[model samples]
Target: MDKNTIIGILLIGAVIIGFSIYNQPSEEQIKAQQELLAKQEADKKKAVEQQKAAQKKQEEIKKQTLEDTTALFHQALTGSAENIVLKNDKLELTINSKGGTVTKAVIKDYKSLDGAKDVTLFDEKDQSLSFKIDGKEQNINTEELFFSASEKTDSTVTLTATAGAGKTLTMRYLLGKDYMLHFSLQAQGMEGVFSSKTNAVNVEWNERCRQQEKGFTFENRYATLTYKEKDGGTDYLSETSEKIDERISETLDWIAFKNQFFSAMMIAKNDFAPNASLTSIPQQKESGYLKEYKARVETFFDPTGKTPTELEFFFGPNDFRLLQAMEKESKFGKDLKMERLVYLGWPLFRIINRWFTLYVFDWLTNLGLNMGIVLILITLLLKAITYPLVKKSYMSSAKMRVLKPKLDEATKQYDKPEDQMQKQQAMMQMYAQYGVSPLSGCLPMVIQMPIWIAMFNFVPNAIQLRGESFLWIEDLSTYDPIAEWGTNIWMIGDHLSLTCILFCGANLLYSWMTMRQQRDQMVGAQAQQMKMMQWMMFLMPLMFFFIFNDYSAGLNFYYFVSLFFSAAIMWALRKTTNDEKLLKALEARYQENKNNPKKVGGLAARLEAMQKQQQEMQRKREELERKRKGV
Candidate 1:
């Protein structure tokens, strides 16, 4: 799209967004409103009232079990179960089933997937599991059952544990169940293993039961198969599977399933709550934006016992090609597609990265050149390609700068708020006579935002940058190391990351330079707008500190390099574009147009007319504002 069209669209979008946000209800108010509606419905209908009572009773029972299970899981978080044996593999930490259902699976080895010693994998008190397996041991707790597995197989590993009334719990992984990864969970009375269909996986109880209500509840959000059985009754709850794709299938294995994908560590502290999935897309938090754009998979289990839960997990890359091979979600690979905007210059960037990874990084594997340096090279290349456009923008800004003194005079003359509209129109006429476009300078910068966002997503997730070192930073995939005095301090974490700090400083410097130039050339509300821009720019890096602290150092490195390069380019432009020459040229053009009216005919005159119309609109708006304020 053209610059004018893009800017117009952006302005309209901004207005619509502002109106929407202003009209939207707050969280607490929405909750209260829903509660009131529920109450009103209950008061009107007897059936509604009865349903509410039943729901409340079920909620209380569920809450009690959740709390109890969570507590028990917390106790077992640090300790290992008796019937489980833990073994470490290159890819995964395998928990072998000796003879027990996992009361809790606390995979502590993956605390820091980025390979940090201090970062804890699981919250010791919140994430835990409770379950009974078919095992010889009556009461087994796998305190030391933390393992990793390398191979990708659907081998049936038998698990045995104790249940309520002291019943035997037997569950096994069913091999050749599915092409991707499969878990065939079978209990005493349960028949056949549950498998995912096109949209869902049905968890049926016994042989002949077709009723959905009989110990069954399907959860579209979680993609889980749940079955609840008491002496008198049986119940079931099934959750819809989470997003999955090719990358996930490619990297799918035992280790990552437990570590990165599965929050089994949460089970250590007895936190068995499933990760939020994209069931209600619109109502979902913006935090899930990336998740929806990318790929995710998670699993939850409940083995009926004093503590009934043996959780299995799967987390890894979203490999679209690999997912296409899997039958579960034929759409998994289909949905994990990148947008056109996302692919802007992406092909080039990927090619460059691949070359570096395959050729450069390989040759110099040990002596890691700083990622910061790599970023500088990339910035230099980008700047070279964009130099022509950058120069044009700079020239436009320079022309505007020359006209500023005249604009200031016009502003002062029509200083009254009541005459603001007249003043703005007069200023536009002045610009027309001088041949200047105020917004031309902002077009290039505005167009670069999408590219910036694309890069932001790329560098953080890039496997090439992970574990690679640059200067004092040990891991390019994580925060820079520094001397730590304490732990968990706000912005100043234990040890401040060097790249993030540098990025913030660079941002402040860039903002200061740009603001200084604008302030020198602006007046009235325009000057105030410049000040606001300055404040926003200054606050941006600080705002990102928390969010980006854990991000790949390569991203921070890229920002720092890009800022420095842009500033350098700006400085060069200022030096090359002579103010005197530009003023003389503008004056010469104005004189030529005035003397030879034909020189300003056709399209130029039409543009001048449109500019005049826009200025008139601006004046009218200002007049309305003044009348509303009674100025």
Candidate 2:
């Protein structure tokens, strides 16, 4: 029985085994599946190999491009550099073959700051002018390459260079009798050498301005980078900031490196490219360098290399007259307006200096008078011009002096804060009745301040007075040091200037005279305040002595003469004016004002309105206070 059961179970198990085996995949199908998997693996391997081949080809192209660029750069830099010199009546320039740029510029008529030798604005190591050309196959900098010089002359020179692949660049320079040097840059036969899409060439100009003045701090204060936009006005970087980095998106007309009394300018006859940049970094205090200036500009360039650009270089003193004449005589049909480099205050003060002070100074110098004498005469002339204003101011002060007793009586009624508004109204009424304006004296003084400030700016920057000598002073443009301690102090330098001391003395005397007159006119608290301010005025001269000790001797001398003239004129005014007559006139005017009861206008009307507003506010404040106190 066990055999029969086992056989049946075995038969069922065999049938199940056979069915499972039949349902499984055949060998041909398995082989086909395996072949498909293998084909996919082969396709992925082929794709990876193709990708690697593409990357290798790209790397080879990059390497070839780098080698081509290096070869081109080497070709451009193969020649030896040479230098050519050109001289004119005012300037001497050395042109370098490397970049066909000015390597050195010397002023023939000027001496160094120490009076040891001729002044050199820049040297080979301190300046560079370079061009960057972006071509289809190569990019190169001209500054690192060399050029061949040809057609050399005493006042002109031409340089030619190759940019590989039938491209040529030429730079020509011509020096005139004046401070101007004409420069031209031309590109020839560069059809496929540069990128045809862009129409601009990049230029870089850098200069380290050496100190050529007696005062480095003063010179550095004036050292700045100035630029004029094409069809726009002139602008400048901040001179007082530590570093300046500016970008101009508009076209530029010119760029300049302006020192205190001199400048080096580059003028573009056409216009620069639409984008440019300028940077400046001040050197160390004792580095003998005023500033480091850099300009990155773009100029119009044709890929066809047909047209050329004309430019100009001006290396000279910052003489206002010369610059003005140059502006008038410009051949580019644009006013360069280089005279703006002169630091003679803003427009109003500059107009005064240009129209009055400089003309007078020139006239006086033409008379063969020494600069000191010219300064004195100019001071006297200016005093005469302002004598009317001074007299009016003094007369106003005297009239107020005559009315002081009445003003004091009025002020006594304003002893408490509650009476402040009423007291102010009463004082204003009295002033209106007497026709005495408290600001009249100050107004006249304010009108004369611009002239004084203009002169102060003009004298220090006047190149005409640079080497002019006067009594006890060898150079008027620098401090006349009577003694030098060889140590720097706060505000005061190591040297003591005689002209500065004299200026301080004159200022002190003028201050004393003015203070005495003002003090005699005031009483009580005002007199006390005047006395304190008189001491402060005396201290002002001492403070100025320290400040001016290192300043220009011509400026100090001019100030001294101006102060002396002011004191003398004031003394004469006091002697000629009769106080009793002034008092009587003031009383008569007051009586007439009371009788006529004239309608107030101008400042009096404004003051009355303000007083009314203030009195109303005070009344409201008192009413509120009473309500709060329930009184």
Candidate 3:
């Protein structure tokens, strides 16, 4: 071997030795690494232990919950419920031992649309009442528990639910001789059982309003939840809205689940607490249900089982007189005003029906008149009451018709667009001089509109005509379907109503005749406008046919007969009266009152003032334009 190669090998060995010494870990570093490895192993072991402990704790909690739930409510968890019935002259109630509530309500005096069966207000599945008992272990509802029913008395029954060790909840029902069902609840030895701080129980009533009438669309429009606040006016949730949730922030006295002609109402003997929630959810029309109504109210109970929370139920036909005679049966000791459920109309129309139409119809019916004859008599009575105004209206229109030649001559004098206000003013002046107000014809009709609308409202809700048949009509209180199909149609239902068609025809004929009387009296743009209105008026009846196709047969019949007779009367007057005599009388009166200031003091004066103001402004604008043009 060469000496250089040997030296290179020694140097390489030395370099390797030095690098090993420089990169080697110290004793402290090795000790730290050992400690870190031991810590990681300990942490892994701790995590495993914690996971096992948490799982065991969760299992213990679940087991405790199950045991607690089984302790107080074990016997009530499963059982067959008993039904006890209480009947009266007007109502029949079935109370179930499951929830100790009325499971079924039947109005005994009314029949269903099927005609043979009685009207069942609600069945077991349609309605359920539950009482809530908050437990320290588990929240509980009494609707799931089985109750022990006591033997029935003449008018009362008591249902009791025993929790254990003498803890009991009792519900008692006393049937009134009429449509009211009295209910009360009391608790015994439930100090530690009920976790309620206020010692009040929640009373939840859920009800699905089923179709009661033959016309589901029409009847469903009237089915809703109506309530009255304590010391306040009556109110209702939207009948048309699909879903509505309302928390009555104030206390309530009564809540009514009102169908078209029937109602199931609950009245609080004291007052239901604030925050009572009223919910309305619309069900499918084909489901044979109209709406699902729910009311959640809190009422206090006596923990010692002495004083009971009292409530009353009203289940019957919504007969206005009968309901008006019901007891002042609520919290504020005010009249129940249960008659409001039989909705007549809004304020003015309602007043007319309540005061006049109702009494007259009752009197006529009591006198053994048929319902159709009664409606005819009502129409005749109203016409007779306003005969003088009708005569005056016709005479005013005749006066305008007779003076058409002179008004046309005046129109010829002012034929430009700029002369419109002047022409209108001149026409008004002529009307004043002739003692013929253009509004004279309309004023009487306007005054009589309330009575007309009152009858419109009165006939549909007139329960006296429910089953009364006249000619081809089977039921006056529902649509008289002359033709029916199996499937439903949009905007038009499954059937066509005969009375509704007749009513539309009468309306169209009457409108055409009335327009022909006045159409010739207008000229120029006014004539064009009247011609447009004639078409609109003709279409109004067609639109009404769609809107009122499902209205009560009695209402349509009344309108048809009323409008037909009105047209006949107008035609008779047209034939029997002499236009020459009316013109002569107007001419004589014009001569006598042409200068009388008193004759022009009221509406005519105000109209003249407005026209003059408008004319004066028009003149100013014209003068300004002329100056701007340097003319």
lDDT of 1 at 263: 20
Error (Å) of candidate 1 at residue 226 is: 18
Can you write out model 2's per-residue Cα lDDT over 419-537, one digit (the tens) per residue? 76776677667777777665666754585688779998899888888888887888898888888886788778778889999999998998898788777666445576575566568
Each model's backbone clash number: 71, 0, 0
Candidate 1, residue 36: how far the Cα is off, in Å: 9.5
Compose the digit string of candidate 3's lDDT tens values, residues 1-631: 3465579879999999999998898999999999999999999899889999966874565456447654665566557988888997778888888877888988886778767558898999899888875566555577767888886875799887777777777888888778878788887886676554646778899999988888887788778799888877788888888554588998888899888888899888777889998999877878998999999888766555667788888888878888876754333366667788888888999999999898888899899998989988998888888778887787777778888877888777787878888888888777777766677767556857888788877776777887888989988888999899998898788999999999999999988988987875675667766865676789989999999899889989999988888888778877877978877887887777765756654455567677889899988999999999999
TM-score for each candidate, following the candidate numbering: 0.51, 0.82, 0.85
Q: What overall lDDT, based on C-alpha atoms, would model 1 receive against the true structure?
A: 0.45
Best by TM-score: 3
When summed lDDT is taken over every stretch of 10 residues in candidate 2, the lowest stretch is: 69-78
Candidate 1 error regions (>4 Å): 1-374, 406-416, 523-552, 595-631
lDDT of each: 0.45, 0.80, 0.81
How much does candidate 1 score in TM-score? 0.51
Tens digit of per-residue lDDT, candidate 1, span 1-631: 3465569879999999999999999999999999999987777798767899967874564455446653212222233433332322212223344322222222332334334432222222222222322222222223212222223243445554332332334444322222222233333422112122211111111111111110011111221121111111211122223422222212111111111122211111111222212111111221211111111223333332223232233222222222223323222222212111111135555554444332443344335655656656656766787778777776777877887876787778777767766666666555566666656677657645544565664554443554566677676655664555545576554555678778777877777767776676666767766765675677877887765555556777778788888788888778877799899998997797778765554333455577678777877999999999999
What's the true lDDT of residue 565 in model 1? 80
State the local distance difference test value for candidate 2. Answer: 0.80
